[model samples]
Target chain A: MSEINSSKTVSIISRQAPYGSNRAHQSLDIALAAAVFEQAVNYIFMGDGVYQLLGNQNATSIQSKTLVNALETLDLYGIESIFIDSQSLRERNLTPKDLALNASIVSRGEIAKIVRASDSVFNL
Target chain B: MSTLHTVSKAPSFRLLETCLSIIQAGDAVLFIEDGVYHCQQSTELLRNSEVKFYCLREDLIARGLIDRKLDTIETVNTQGFVDLCVQHDGIVNWF
Candidate 1:
């Protein structure tokens, strides 16, 4: 990469559920890695992706590490900027009260702004 | 003004059928990712309808179904896929 000196802002949009496939996990890993590399990584949960933040997820029942638990470790990774699509939560009949973590609840316009501000965007 | 419906999931996901419902008669469909599996069972459906069906060639080969007859369905490269998207007026990425 030519601009190796500059740390770019990378945005990841997870539009899938956390439990079904490894897409959610892989997406998270990318964000964590980017953050570790000192990139300004912004996470936006949209559509089915918003389900990732549901409280009290029990992965032990499925014999897997709870993604919700892994999500808790984001703070240790230095990922403090998280945004959730307010409209998506509304469409899913969920409220911010139901979320496992505290994040900025943004509108569609704000979501657009977040994407626009980033140098790169990823989706899973 | 035709729609290019891009499907990334297999029929087992029920996304192919859902994508079909929204596609008009003159629209086209481009199968990518696991959607290439639907191409195996979609030949008959495409031949009888006005809709044109296509799948990514690399994905077909990756799935080890390159020799599959394909019949009325066309196999295209990544560039060809971009051309198809450009030719269409709209695109629907069905999950």
Candidate 2:
């Protein structure tokens, strides 16, 4: 068994679209909680999750809180190290310029490596 | 190695099964998000597993299934959820 350590790394992987649903938001809430607790937290956006980072989101049309607005609060909460899958963005015809917030773009292989390094991972 | 498996969707069972196959005893499986619905179904597969099973209390409440009786499954709140992550050495997400 691996020896337990005082510091923990938690990774939150967002795979749902922004708005029109509560899954992605709830996931962010947990991520924020872990960050506030002073834990090492990382957020990864993959699959349809890349859409959550798209810029200029206005959820008023759908009667939902904009996802980008929620994500903007991450840095303030000490939850840095946000990443998005490059392939996901490419598949959706989106680029980093389309994202409202700044985040590193990573390949699937890189994402796998990040997951391997994390002590705990939450998918939503 | 101690692996913490978190499942949040019923469709994720395929991935969860794959994870369970690789994980031995002494590991834990936590069901959260919409994954809490999986706990409601009683099946031979679940009955046979030695892995520790857990459900998120807040998720169950949100789904209006909090009052339902469950067998062989432990319910945990957000704090307990954080504790679980701390207790396990690794985490696998099945969405």
Candidate 3:
């Protein structure tokens, strides 16, 4: 059982905004925590979660830490596999260029394939 | 085959109702996280169903609901939680 969970691919689906709420941060934290355990972790940004990737975020005005800055720490945590939903980006009128981070834009079908392949999926 | 439905919210019983209607008898319903709070009151959802109901032992303890009247709800530990998931064919997390 430990072997299955240890070798299992986990996909963390983020569906909320980055700031003003704990959901998105908690999702990222869980991914980071799982990665530390040497588990395979993949991140999927959809819906309002795409906002976390937006560049030039200045949360100082609101006395909050910029979510984009926190997201930049993912690479250092060894979590490189990241994806953004194409339809969600279109709906939000955002392009890859608007994002501070580099990630693949995936179709909904592709997202489903990732979920199906994962041994466990954590949705936020 | 049975499916383990993990509920994580208090007012999210709408999905539970839908799940109960579709699930066959002898299937189990294990409530965890904040959903364990719902075990306090006997709702229509709990009264009419023949499905076995359960709650996370640790969660109930954490919430200070230990020794409370939880109807027919049984408590299971994390290991038991995993076992229940393994016993079931699928898992539907309703949060």
Candidate 4:
């Protein structure tokens, strides 16, 4: 039995790139926390947010931890479903191979469907 | 005396527009944080040759924008940021 009375489907749409702002971290943290609570969490990377999935990131010089570390833990928390906007990736000249994690490349219509199915939406 | 204008937000915000409008010749604008996204809008900034343009190298690299950065804007490190501050008489922060 889940701890919470209602397990709402929470969707976190991250639009900012990692290290540029805290929004990316904030979204990941919330998604993990929500998943821990036994809620169905959907994490979607769009726009600049797609940059968060890029590999070969070393933030040591900047004195910041690489967000990819936390991103790797999402699956361990049972948050397996990760989505990335296809247009965003194409516009940024990034391909699925460039990302550190495995995420489903979704279109605008598909993204809208996910958002619509979500019980709660957080656009960061 | 010159000013070191720091922009920490994206061009989507009117802050950059306003900052550019009021910036004087010899002033420098340093794009930090999300401001590095302004690399896409470098052509607009090029209109003012008198004003200098810079971006935090760490921030740019973190966003995977190092290769995509424009030639006109110089990349600087944190230490270089401090140097720019020292070189200017005042600082203007545009959020």
What TM-scores result for chain A when each predicted structure is judged separately against the true chain A? Answer: 0.94, 0.90, 0.91, 0.95
lDDT by residue (tens digit), candidate 4, B1-95: 67787889887774566556546668799999999998855566556888899999999999999999988899999999999999986665655
DockQ of 2: 0.21
Measured with C-alpha atoms, the lDDT of residue A111 in candidate 4 is 70
Per-model interface RMSD values are 9.2, 5.2, 7.0, 17.9
lDDT of each: 0.80, 0.79, 0.78, 0.83
Mind giving the per-residue lDDT tens digits that candidate 4 earns over A1-124?
5556888888888878999799999999999899989999999887789999989998887999999888977999999879998988998999999999998999866775666566666767
Question: Who is ahead in TM-score, 2 or 4?
Answer: 2
Model 1: CA > 4 A from native: A1-4, B1-95
Clashes of each: 0, 0, 0, 0
Model 2 chain A: which ten-residue window has the lowest total lDDT?
A: A1-10
Name the top lDDT candidate. Answer: 4
**Colliding pairs, model 2:** none
Residue B56 CA displacement from its true place in model 4, Å: 37
Q: What share of the true interface contacts does each candidate keep?
A: 0.00, 0.44, 0.00, 0.00
lDDT digits (tens) for residues A31-98 of candidate 3: 98888877888998977889989999998999887888878888888889899988789989999999
Q: Which of the predicted structures, 2 or 4, would earn the higher lDDT when compared with the native?
A: 4
lDDT of 1 by residue, A1-124 (tens): 5555778888887878976888889889999999988999998887789999999999889888899888877889989889998978998999989999899998766765565466666756
B85: Cα error in model 3, Å: 5.3
Kindly list the per-residue Cα lDDT of model 2 for residues B40-68, writing each as its tens digit.
77655466466898999999999887877
Q: Which candidate is the best by DockQ?
A: 2
- B-chain TM-score for every candidate: 0.89, 0.87, 0.84, 0.94
